[model samples]
Target: MKKIRKSKTEQLNFGNYSFEVIKKKIKNIYFRVYPSKGKIIVSAPFSIDSETLNKAILSKSDWLNKQVKKAAIAKPEPVKTYITGEKLLFKGEIYSLYVDYRHTGPRVAKTFDKVIHLKVKPGTDFPQREKIIISWYRKELKRSIGMYIDKWQPRIGVTVNEFNVRKMKTRWGSCNVNAKRIWLNLALIKCAEKFLEYVIVHEMIHLLERKHNARFKSLMDRFIPDWKRLKKELNRFSL
Candidate 1:
């Protein structure tokens, strides 16, 4: 097997380290070391300077190495293939799809057996099909957000005054601490049940911890021990 190498020009530093210059359509950076071996892997923008990035990574080498090891032992990524007739997860259960072409416009209706039935006109284009599905997703998110907020408010001991759903580019959810409100990305409706719960719990926890600091992680760990795993799984899905 080929050994992974670090850029020699990169510098190393110490402390709770993170690279500042890397950005992606996906907000977070992913770190991985092949076959459960080698230095910490940091996936960031290609333009970042190797020297400065290396220094930051080295600063938090101990913590970063532990995370890499944990990732190695973590469960394999969930199978999230997007194929016809495949069942999708909602809340915490499987909801199969039955695609049909009777409706003039694309529409989605819930079946008696908890399945989502999508009605598309014959020969509908991909963009049209996607729009219909996404519209349904937004509706599902709006319908479900209230219930999650109600369930988690008491658990976390924080009451969110208001919340809304929309298409978010960077995160699955965000909270306004000052306004006591939360906003969720409609894309979450397509993820696993546990992943949905993780996002909800994550946002709700923010009412108590405004920043992603130690206390925030502690809260998440207390509520969702498998959050890190769920996060990795969520990333495997298309937004």
Candidate 2:
């Protein structure tokens, strides 16, 4: 039987580029670049020495430089103020918002021509209004997540114990394989429904394979043939 090496992480600096290197029991080295901040991460096998790793990184300097340049000039999304006539993203579609101050509980509804109607009590402040919209997003996302779980659990042949939604800064979703629980990012509600489903399926797959290895990629291909594309598209959105 083959033994797996325990993974360890360390920081490496090469001139202007710094990388977070994780030495794991893996066959090949992998590089990931975060376009938003030009962060680079390298996953290398435990057997690789620092000299070899440095050489490998140097070979990819051109590609890394291009990615960092793009990040330097990247434009960030505008901050939302949750006001009337402001465009909001939901299910990958943008909708113009209409705020209605009524003597009623906070409610949100969608009407014709891609418009979202948000009804709140009179004298509601900005934070209050934002809270109301967030509450509505959570409710709708939960409802849809329940339906997707029901639909995919049978096909995937995995029984999830439970799932939760919350605001996550880094990850779209995560699965606790032993507990059979999944956590989805609350921000997913703003993207397309397909993106949400992709995240769900990705987390569920972790129940079967804990690591993102060849076996995991094979399983993803079997389930979501275009998952590579979906993943690329989904990452284009900020957390």
Candidate 3:
């Protein structure tokens, strides 16, 4: 099921960022820097004022700066027609799409020549074509992440009970530390293997450190020194 995104109650500008301040029924203030373009969101109690909310978001300027930089690199994708001669992003490289219609069912394949061969049933519509491509992406992502987990689980000193691949709008991946399970975004198949490894290590590290604090960063540095840069690169193109 899809989640209903909470509506924004107000918006404010602070420093180099324009963020939304949402007044919720909750008790405490919540600050969030979304992975996509590093959107800043602050969820606060209804009793909070504009000045207080501004100050709260301002205090995290340094963190917000990095998020803004990441956001700046993002390029929104144009509406897709799923037609011939279109380009597809896969493994950090763009592939020329070749649509074929001589198959009983839709299937996708990539060639060493950097071409994506999509063989679908004759005269498929846009939605069916999209479903075919997405299904292919999911299958490939699952296979790829399985290999990554096998390689990293021993190195990261963690055991994963299960791994799932699905469409996640806000995050590339998530971890269930208690269950030793992880969920990876279906869009990850579009990223390079190095960036994919970074995400895998990131979620695995969460199994050790539940919070993104000093120790969490220290571990990321130890594992992938240029993780921050790769993160920006990964978000350079919108899914």
Candidate 4:
């Protein structure tokens, strides 16, 4: 019942990169740039000719090369100081930080107009403030992931035995295919909700396919055709 499906694939050498062009029953041509492997995949309509695809790739060659180079030397995110004027990102939106120390307790809230309100006792050091902010991040990310799990578990025909949120340096999420447990990067709290959902579905899909092979990509295409785009958005954040 999937509306969009891949029909075939063609490989070609274009510009400085060798990539695959996936012919699909889709409306628009799409490109996916991967950060970990510095790979690229292009999906285009079945009717599109090779010359057109070549031109498209050539046009974006420079940007593509930069992305690959960036991926090759990707850096880890530095520890945050959580000071005033620093920005926080949530659900794809930016929130400016405002720290208030007048109150006796530490608090965190997102205002209706797009600002993150942080309140802590005076003289609170970095460690204490970090704990407070991370606690809030975990709580919020958990709530969001729970909803996604509820929505996707049944659809994907999988159950997660355990869900964990932790600080991760290399990956956004991981699935213990044997244990039915999924661990999400704590940093995801700063990403948009769509990417969060994509990661959840990506991990859950592992329950059905253990490898990122053709079958896995096919499943992802069926479940979330826009997953490639979501992955790019998710990795836009460092670390």
Candidate 5:
């Protein structure tokens, strides 16, 4: 078995723009721009030298500008202060935030009335409060992901060594075939359960077929007949 190398990352600056360059065991270079945050990420093969990569990226300057301009058309939402009255997204529904002061450690819970109660010690700062909520999201997401993985493993005729949840701006999920691990985005917690299931199944199918070719589509079609509609709806949300 070929051991996967830890991808090397560096910052690349060209003119007025900066890119997060990541070199991985990939065949081709891929550029992804997150318009909501104006973040640019470049993934290239390790065999390619920086000079060639720079030239390739520089050549796409025009395309990058167009994407940036298109993104500018939509106004970005204001930054969240993680205070009361702010909306919290959970399971594809918006909930009003309710902060509860307590002598106990920080925690998060949702009420029957669509309110997310964030319980924290008195005088907990914004960063700490945000961290608490994120921690809660991670735990909840992991539990849900486990349920899906267990439910699909036998059906798909594959087993996963492990799965992880993280904040990803570009992709919802990724599969490390060699590691038998799948990474689910923390953002998926905000989407509907069906959308989350769609992503999970999509990544699981990668174990059978690494590339997204006809065989992959056939597997997806057999497993999720309406995945195309789910994918369309899921993309409407910002990562």
Candidate 6:
């Protein structure tokens, strides 16, 4: 990991509860701390005095420590490598991947035993293989979206004017209220059917409530009681 250098005008304050920093930014001086993980990161501008920064971080010591500890306990997802025979979670089950070389363009076919057989050229690199498999997944997602939308529209008492499926980096789904359109992540195909339903329901609910306020939660709860658990499980799988 790269080291985070302290700002020239910043000062570190030590407390029994947590780590914190007082930073002076162009507009203001602020104390920042990662309480859950016990890591305190402060940012300040060039003009702030060290003594003032230190006092600010110390004043928020208790809250800072809590944030640091929480941050510390939070584990990041492990990096994954695309290799032959690796187990991939698909639709709530582990399926072994089989990579083979062929003279044609990259192709993915399923075997009778439920393994995903990816065929690429002998010298193809990891990126090429990933693209091929991802493209196939997108196609599959597009095919399934209509079925779910058809089933859930009437049940939810809402209508989605248009929707599309693609690879998304930040979120699983997004809704365009003005256009009455929804977009879903192709990566969601890896999760279970119920989880996919949750995402669909989530986006559809956006047509009713623009933001994730109390009303949205209530709507989701009324439709799917176990959404939280399903979301956690979905996060466990790779995107």
**lDDT (10s digit) by residue, model 4, range 88-134:** 66665667778889657788988999888889989988888778888
Pairs that collide, model 4: 92-192
Judging by TM-score, tell me the better candidate of 2 and 4.
Answer: 2
Regions of model 5 farther than 4 Å from truth = 1-77
> What is the Cα-based lDDT of residue 108 in candidate 6?
85
Ranking of models by lDDT: 5, 2, 4, 3, 6, 1
Question: What lDDT would each prediction earn against the true structure?
Answer: 0.67, 0.86, 0.81, 0.83, 0.87, 0.71
Better of 2 and 6 by lDDT: 2
| Global Cα lDDT for candidate 6 | 0.71
Q: Alpha-carbon error at 18 in model 6, in Å?
A: 34
Task: Give the per-residue lDDT digits (tens) of candidate 6, residues 1-239.
Answer: 99654554323435554334444335565545442343556666666676866676667767765554334323332344556877655554457788888787588877668798888888998887777877887787777788898998998889999999887877889999999899998777776677788899889988889988999989989988988887775564445
TM-score for each candidate, following the candidate numbering:
0.53, 0.68, 0.66, 0.66, 0.68, 0.59
Residue pairs in steric clash, candidate 3? none
| Candidates 2 and 5, the one with greater lDDT | 5
Global Cα lDDT for candidate 5:
0.87
Better of 4 and 6 by lDDT: 4
After superposition, which runs of candidate 3 have C-alpha atoms over 4 Å from their true positions? 1-73
lDDT of 3 by residue, 12-97 (tens): 77777777778777888887777554467888987777788778777877877765544433555557778888877777667889
lDDT of 2 by residue, 55-100 (tens): 9999999988866643432324467778898877777667889999
Clashing pairs in model 5, backbone N/Cα/C closer than 3 A: none
For residues 1-239, could you state the per-residue lDDT of candidate 1 as single tens digits? Answer: 99544322232333543332323334334555443333444655444556755665666577666554444333243453323575655543457767777747567877668687778778776677667777777778777778777888898999989988888777888889899988988767755456767888898898998999999999999998989888886764545
